[model samples]
Target: MLRLSKKTDYALMAMKHLALHGDRGASSAREIAEQYDIPAELMAKVLQRLVRRGLLLSHQGTRGGYQLARPATLMSVADVIQAVDGPLTVTACSTDDHACDQYTKCSVRDPLWRIKDRILTALAACTLAEIVDDTSVPTIPVTLSRRTPAPVTER
Candidate 1:
């Protein structure tokens, strides 16, 4: 199953909190972590990673903390995730890297690559603003809907 690491999850939560309360000035990592019941040390590490990645700006002072380096609308979710977890990869051997032992006979490799690209595209298209905003963000076309289809009728 596809999943985001715990650190990545913390980074996203911190970002949303920062976006929501950014206007109030920089927020200390402890403050944000406490709001969500996360470990302060771990959240601080995540924020530091974001800071190093240029996704967040760190302020050094008595009242200083961390804040978004740019507008939330301009930063994609992919940026945040990548900063926290490096690159996103769903398969063992992506098209660019066929280092897997089964690369030669892997029939599903190419198709999985396409699916990986789609996932990356979707992540890159979604902005951090959408996470904290109540308004709708544009929806992506989905091949599968979780809901069951109604019975077919005779035309």
Candidate 2:
């Protein structure tokens, strides 16, 4: 199954936290980690990676921490995922041509490529701002419909 790495998850959470508290000024990695119950060391590393990727700005010394390098609305989910986990790949052969042994004989390669592209487009369309803002919406109610089973007849 396709899934995002834990690092990516942490990165997204951190970004959302920063965006929410942006007006309060920068936040330390420890503060974010503590608020979310994440490991401080791991959060620190994640924040550092984001800074290196140019998605976050780091401030040093007392009362200093990290902040978003750009507006959250300008940053997509794909950007955070990519920054933490590199490129997104649905299949082994999606990235490198030699990644799969059946590279030369793969019949579904084109279809897989198209699927990957669509998935990326969807991810790119969603921004951190949209996600953070969505928190205020009421949860949709889910209703399950019950269906009666058909009687089995002997042939």
Q: Considering every candidate listed, which one attains the maximal lDDT? A: 1
Off by over 4 Å in 2: 135-155
> Which 10-residue window in model 1 sums to the lowest lDDT?
133-142
RMSD of each: 5.3, 5.7
C-alpha TM-scores of all predictions: 0.87, 0.84
lDDT of 2 by residue, 6-91 (tens): 98999999999999999999999999999999999999999999999999999999989999999998999889999999987877
Q: Tens digit of lDDT per residue, candidate 1, span 70-139?
A: 9999999899999999888888776688688899998887788788888989999899999888476777
Error of 2 at 94 (Å): 3.3
Model 1: residues with Cα > 4 Å off, grouped in runs: 95-98, 144-155
Residue 124 C-alpha lDDT in model 2: 89
- TM-score, prediction 1: 0.87
Clashing pairs in 2: none
Error of 2 at 92 (Å): 0.6
lDDT of each candidate versus the true structure: 0.91, 0.90
